[model samples]
Target: MSNPHPLQVERRGSGVPILCLHGHPGSGSAMAVFTEPLSTRYHTLAPDLRGYGQSQVQDPFEMADHIADLEALLDREGIEECLILGWSLGGILAMELALRNPQRYRGLILIGTAARPRGNYPPIPWWEYVNTGIAGLINGVKPGWQWNIDTFGTRSLFRRLLKQHTPTAYHYLAHAGTPAYLRTSRHAHRALNTALRQGYNRLADLPTLTMPCLMVAGADDINITAQSSQETAQTLPRCDWHCFPNTAHLFPWEVPNAMNETIHAWLRQQNL
Candidate 1:
């Protein structure tokens, strides 16, 4: 395989390194909320995956490519080992990283994620379907979904899907109005489509993960159900699962203080 394009990273604080990975249609900025808090105690390194944010865009935006990009980033940083905290699609990539390089990570923190892509997505609401179709059509004409974000501002149709799952944090979690946001969204669309076609499933490999793992889920997350998180936790050899009541997909954003506290406590307990 060819080398992945260089990634742009946001580095903060200094201590045990924590590699933070963001979800689809988002850049390293998506994880910015946690960086400052995590930075106080640990070295937080958040990278914009290839073709996202300021990273170079390339072809074949698949999971493997994502994995390679991370590997290269770690190497570049001279980080032989670090803790990984991934959210949503980022969690899937974190798992893939552990599978490929088990010795390189100290532990895993998965938030609002599942062990695999759940094919049973509920039917799209009529209003959402119409708006999404319109957005897609417009985005198709203009490579990036910039027009959508520009026209709609903070209430862009692309981000509206998140509103259902992250009502409180929807606006707070909106993508920055930057060229990188548009570029990332365009690349993310391709990467997600490829991921769906590949049918990602890592259940069988979960038991092989011997490192300490923390699975955090939101009870009301409609995107990746709590049931999925529970099932994933059950599969892991060493896992601690926690579900926040009344919270949804963007629990970290919704309750950053609480989330950071929990994570700090967990890391201290693990001595990592």
Candidate 2:
């Protein structure tokens, strides 16, 4: 599964490198908030995995393709060893990479992800249709947000409404309409979902990742419950786990400062 294609990376700062991997339906830009602060102290490398963002791929691919891309990416970057930070789908990739060759990574930071996904890929929830229609109606008048028919492909309405009724709602809503998000390939989205549905269980491999690891999850994240992260942490030999209260799957964006502080403190304590 050697991918000759090099992933498009977003690199920043210098010194120890930290490879930041974004979740499904996300590009390297999604990790900017977390990587920006860390870049001051550590070199951060965020890459758009194939079929996502600028690293567009036309042919079909799988999880193994992504893993190979990462391995190739590190070699291309001339990084012998680095810390890996992953969110959601990115976390799964991180674990796979570490499991494949533990020595290549110094440590790991996994956020809002699970080793074993619940695999609940139901058709668009009925409520989403209602919300999208409302959002579209609102957009027509106020021009506050953009509307698209591919609600499943573009989560503009869902992301907007998830933040609840607040001034930030508009800001959150705008995320779906952003060029980066909009540019994400719908084919990439379905590929990952299909992989999950086919059964993604790495619980058995958790104990093999001996590197110092940090696992964080949002309590309110129904997509990947906090309990799943805790279970994965318990199996790991060296893991620091945390469950952020009053947060969902997108907790990093919801509480960026707190998440950043927690990661910084952990890295300091571990002397990483």
Count backbone overlaps in model 2.
0
Per-residue lDDT tens digits for candidate 2, residues 1-272, read 44555789999999899999988778888788778999999999999988888999877777788988999889878899999999988999999999999999999999988788542224666676676666555543444433332333135345421332222333433453254566778768777878867988889888878899999987767677778888888888999998888776777766778889999999999999
Please give the RMSD to the true structure for each candidate, in Å.
Answer: 5.6, 4.3
The stretch of ten residues in a row with the least summed lDDT in candidate 1 is 159-168
* TM-score for all models, in order of appearance: 0.82, 0.86
Alpha carbon lDDT at 41, candidate 1:
88
Residue 52 lDDT in candidate 1: 77
Backbone collision tally, model 1: 0
TM-score of 1: 0.82
> Candidate 2 — worst ten consecutive residues by lDDT sum?
160-169
Q: Per-residue lDDT for 1-272 in model 1, tens only?
A: 45766888999999999999987666787787778788988999999887777776646566678888899889989999999999888899999999998999999999889896453245555666566556545544543444464444224333433323232343343433233356574656787887778776789989989999999987777778888888998899998988888766767766767787888888989999
Q: Could you tell me which residue pairs clash in candidate 2? A: none
**lDDT score of residue 223 within candidate 2:** 75
Please list the C-alpha lDDT of all candidates, in the order they appear: 0.75, 0.77
Quick one: RMSD of model 2?
A: 4.3
